[model samples]
Target: MPFTGKSGKFNAAIRTVEIGTGDKAVKLGGENVLPFYTFDAPIENAPKIGVLITDMGLENEVAGIKDYYAGATTFAEIAKKAEEMPGADFVVLRFEGADPNGENRSVEDCVAIAKEVGDAITAPLVIEGCKNVEKDAELFSKVAEALQGKNVLILSAREENYKAVAAAAGLAYGQKVGAESAVDINLAKQLNVLIGQLGVDQANVVMNVGSAAAGYGFEYVVSTMDRVKAAALAQGDVQLQMPIMTPVADEAWNVKEAMASEADMPEWGSQEERGIDMEVETAAAVLASGSNAVILKHPTSVATISKLIKALV
Candidate 1:
């Protein structure tokens, strides 16, 4: 007699989260099994990709992506370009200049730029701050108020500032919040719980598991995400069941493999192709590991990963 392999069943499924409204809306998560485990179960919704933009304007953008920003000086122009890109499902507006150590832009300036980009694009927006906990709370709150009813996903509410961010996004604006954790499943769950305690429904939360670039402990990040999904599905953990989002652009692009010029490292081959590959590969890793959506930087990576997701699904 021949023996066959045993198939396992998951007790829970990833919860679905919707962003935007009307014709521009998109749903993430809702998979009953692990990422791309089609043989075991059906995938209710395919992963989505959001292109990352910044308030830094075109001149400050990376050289590889400058062409996409051609003749687009303002936030509105950049948002338009991002919305028109072939594979961009949504746009992420990163307020990098708002860091108190950086440009230290005022809350008014950040809110103004957020409104401009939010108004220009019909696609859903993911508004992120510059990682300064105190400043980010204030900035996010003001931006959420400024763009009410846009259904934007506020990029982060950490353990340090979840209360203010969650209150502004979930309670005040009725928007979504990206609850972040530092590559730990327990912390990821805990942050979700804290956000929930603030009266934000679990459905309005998305996990950001602190992405690590390829070759720089990427496997650690991947495994952490995998474990988070396993706890959500196999263990029926409600706090971990929400969809996950990874901001891969900054991590992938900033690495030396992507930023080093061809002249600086001839053995690495073409600088352009290398950088694109770094982003595409990093995104693939995260998606396979358990990302329901990702925020990418380069247009080429967006198109490439879009193809990869279609093929996978």
Candidate 2:
């Protein structure tokens, strides 16, 4: 008798969330099995990667990154350089300049830059605010209106600002909404439910469920994602079935291991190498554990993770 394998495919599948438009548009989720479990079931989408660029600019970036985008002075030019990086699936525009406690940039300035990048790139765009609840509430709404027909994905409509973001970006202008939550399964599900109640289709909502550097309490990140996927697939939890998009660049690069200078800790080797390692490690772990998309900073990290996903899926 021939050996037989148990079917691991679940009855329910993760919802597909589409961002952007035309040929460059990317689809996330649409799998009924665990990540990379192609033997169980073929994945409808092979995950996706976004290159993250801050509005403030990448002045202190590593040599490799600097070399890749050499002479790209403007925001639109820089974003185009990022999107052209090998294996990049989209562009994530982070509004660090719009933070009230920091740059305190006005809504008009933010909207101007957003339109520049939005118009410049044919690739899908994801707009993430500066994490201030009030600022993001206004910033996301204004930017959403600015990039109306572009159909961008507004990252992170948290409990605090989901109402404004979901109503304007999602319902009115018809863009994808990212329902963000802290790294808790219940919190994520609840936020998703609330966003859905506002009439944003599940297919148009992606979850920014939170993340941390690898080994820096990232066990919580791993477990939370695993639980979300299991419930969504095996338990048929509709509210938890939205595709997950983790922003890995900030957390991974800001960690002590990635930031420590080679002069300070010779044993840690090059600072650039450490940062790439952290980004790649955290991203790979999250994808395997269940993220449908990831935002990475370094060009090398994005290329490496892109290859990893391509090889695995």
Candidate 3:
């Protein structure tokens, strides 16, 4: 039987990829076929999930997750807690200067935080720079240097920024790099081609399909990812074959269903229940979309989703 009506001979089997550096890096699930389609090929592992660690505190940060980070005043504390969580597969350290309140930290500060988080975990790490193209190039260069040969997943590369970020990963960090794009198959392929032009090996790249929340643009993200996977297996596009990353937790947290409290939105029900539901639903959507890995925040959500993946696979 075909995996998704593409009429390919090979059944979709789950594939795995390890992100980050040192002992902290983790391996996400690998299946030869599409997600939950075990009849074609048995999935050896379940989809892996990572949590995001930032340098600033999330004040009033959505009711459900507020308590989890109450003790995590800094990224260091957050990383320590995440590393302690058995269900967490990887650690994604994001430089959120894109958020004006995030201190507008310089590249030096970003490098320091990356190194600190890198040293603190056994799971693989994903180092992302602020959205500023030129600034990100400079910052990612420092991150690659500080964690050289560490096999981390450096990210936020785009059509405009791929050259600099790709070059930095190849020449400075000697680590894997992640490329991001809106939900477009051709754009994803084109970015990978540009990365190749810079001499970055295909093996060291992860593609980000740019996921959205469950109630938001999730359908678009899911359909795009499914198409990408279908093309990867049937059309033999190596760019689409690389592992996929989804910031499901981040996307879910931003939704009103997750951030709103019982007092503000009684119609939404309890904040904790709503938050977990949003996270689990978002994660479930990503799994269906063929995401190899996801970055999540809540420990409860991770646990619940892990169970769901186990049951489905």
Candidate 4:
């Protein structure tokens, strides 16, 4: 008898979720096997890259990312830069100024900026909240109402604020919501269940299984995501089947390796190159772990990661 290798089989496939509408929409997830496992099963859609834009403008951005928007002054300009970038599939409008302890910008101000950017770019927008749970719930609610039916992805709904954000996303706006959890697979699954119970369709929910920088507990993130996907596929868990999203840029840029200057550590090499590599390497790791979309900063990393994905899938 001739020797033959056993064929691999998967019980469930990742759910496909659509963001935006009409000709500009993008599909995420929809894979029957693990990330880049094309030899085992066909991939329905390639992973996507979402460029991060902020309401605070480039002056408030980290030094490493400021050059990308030199002379740009408005949200419209930022959207234009993202659209022109080679691999940008969507835009993330982070309302950093909405933090109550920070600028404490009004909800009206944040909504105005979101509307401006949404109208400026045809690419789908992910309207991210300031990390303040209470403030984000109220702020996101108003924003969702204003942008109803535009097909935006609201980021996100946590244990403390899932009810308000989920209701805004599914009931008020008919949009999608990102359900976030700490780096625990069970917590992630529970949040997804809670979001669904709030009347948001499971298909409209995306899982943000938590993110960590390259040298800072990134392995934990990988393991959590792996387990989440495994439960969705091998264990036949529907609530855990939503696509995974990782906001890599925020975590990657905040780390010492990405933020430290050459003067601080000459042996570490150029800060610019190190920062770009940090973002690129972190994003690559997350994608390889079955993330369907990654929110990124810096055009250099975006282009590099895009090329890497092309060679991969």
Best by lDDT: 2
> Over 4 Å off in model 3, which ranges?
1-16, 21-24, 28-30, 58-66, 69-74, 98-102
Residues 134-178 of candidate 1 have per-residue lDDT tens digits of 999999999999989988899899999999999999999888999
Task: Write down the lDDT of every candidate, Cα atoms only.
Answer: 0.89, 0.93, 0.75, 0.88
Name the runs in model 4 displaced over 4 angstroms: 1-3, 60-64
Query: What is the Cα-based lDDT of residue 289 in candidate 4?
Result: 91
Those runs of model 2 whose alpha carbons end farther than 4 Å from true positions after fitting are none
Q: After superposition on all CA atoms, what RMSD does each candidate show versus the true structure? A: 1.5, 0.9, 3.5, 1.4
Candidate topping TM-score: 2
Q: What TM-score goes with each of the models?
A: 0.96, 0.98, 0.88, 0.96
Query: 18-88, model 4: which lDDT tens digit per residue?
Result: 99877878998998788888778778799999999888888756565687777777889888788778899
Give residue 56's error in model 2 in angstroms. 0.7
Clashes of 1: 0
Candidate 1, residue 207: Cα displacement in angstroms equals 0.7
Each candidate's clash count: 0, 0, 18, 0
lDDT of 4 at 205: 89
Candidate 3 lDDT trough over 10 residues, lowest sum: 6-15
Per-residue lDDT of 259 in model 3: 75
Where does model 1 exceed 4 Å of error?
Answer: 1-9
- Candidate ordering by TM-score (highest first): 2, 4, 1, 3
lDDT of model 3, residue 82: 77
